[model samples]
Target: MASSDHYFYVLQCADNTLYAGYTTDPIRRLAQHNNGTGAKYTRLLKRHPMRMIHLEHFSEKSPAMQAEYAFKQLSKPQKLRYLTEHSSEWLPK
Candidate 1:
């Protein structure tokens, strides 16, 4: 795979909750969440995921997973701040 394949992403679900995850394609992963074939938590929520709100591209799965862990450790407010600050840098055009 290419160096741009890994991605650490955050999604804003229909219920206003955010979910952090790592994937090779954020868009496709979001689609999977919406289609109920993604994470077990998202699948159990039964709420359609709205979109990928933030993401950090990585060249390796380990790095992406590390980013995901760091993101998940942040409080909701901190996560929101991170998304707000990095929104322009990560979100797809």
Candidate 2:
């Protein structure tokens, strides 16, 4: 069996706002967000069918949450730059 690790992910809402969060299962969590069963931030925004734009893996919840919080603190331009440069497609170091 695979060991569980937390993941920090960035989602692009319909209005193009970025939302950061941590989850053990990105796919299921994305589904929840789309179905309006996820975070109140996403749900209340009425930004359904969100698209995942980035993801980072962490061995523990603390680091995962820390990543989410850090991403959330970034300004829009900084967030966009971070996504463009540190995209999940590049893979983690």
Candidate 3:
């Protein structure tokens, strides 16, 4: 069976915009985002390198997926504020 641990993440695009997603491997996912091979929204904003600014690990895929959905619903400024307050936990290492 696949490992239960998954991650929901957010990236700060070059344009200072946020993109949220879920994945089993954050390192690879970041690569895809940078390479313009990730989500369509991210691809469109790939003019500026996407930098990982937030990530939350989950023990199950369902919860992580749910978070991703909720994150997508957040307004841009709300997401930015979230990142600001959660900087210590989410900022790139």
> Please, what are the lDDT tens digits per residue for candidate 3 over residues 1-93?
998779999888887677889999999999998888888888875445988878889999999999889878888767767777866655532
The local distance difference test score of model 1 is 0.81
Q: Candidate 2 — worst ten consecutive residues by lDDT sum?
A: 84-93
Error of 1 at 62 (Å): 1.5
RMSD of 2: 4.5
User: Total clashing residue pairs per candidate?
Assistant: 0, 0, 0
Tens digit of per-residue lDDT, candidate 1, span 3-91: 56899898877787889998987778888998888988789654674677787888888999998999899998898788878887434
After superposition, the stretches of candidate 1 with alpha carbons farther than 4 Å from their true spots are 1-4, 89-93
Residue 7 displacement (Å), model 1: 0.1
Positional deviation of residue 81's Cα in model 1 after best superposition, in angstroms: 0.9
**TM-score: model 1 vs. ground truth:** 0.83
Per-residue CA lDDT of candidate 2, range 37-68, in tens? 89888886557668888888888888899998
Candidates 2 and 3: which is better by TM-score? Answer: 2
lDDT of 3 at 62: 95
Query: How displaced is residue 86 in candidate 3, in Å?
Result: 2.9
How high is each candidate's TM-score? 0.83, 0.84, 0.84
lDDT, each prediction: 0.81, 0.83, 0.82
Off by over 4 Å in 2: 1-3, 44-46, 88-93
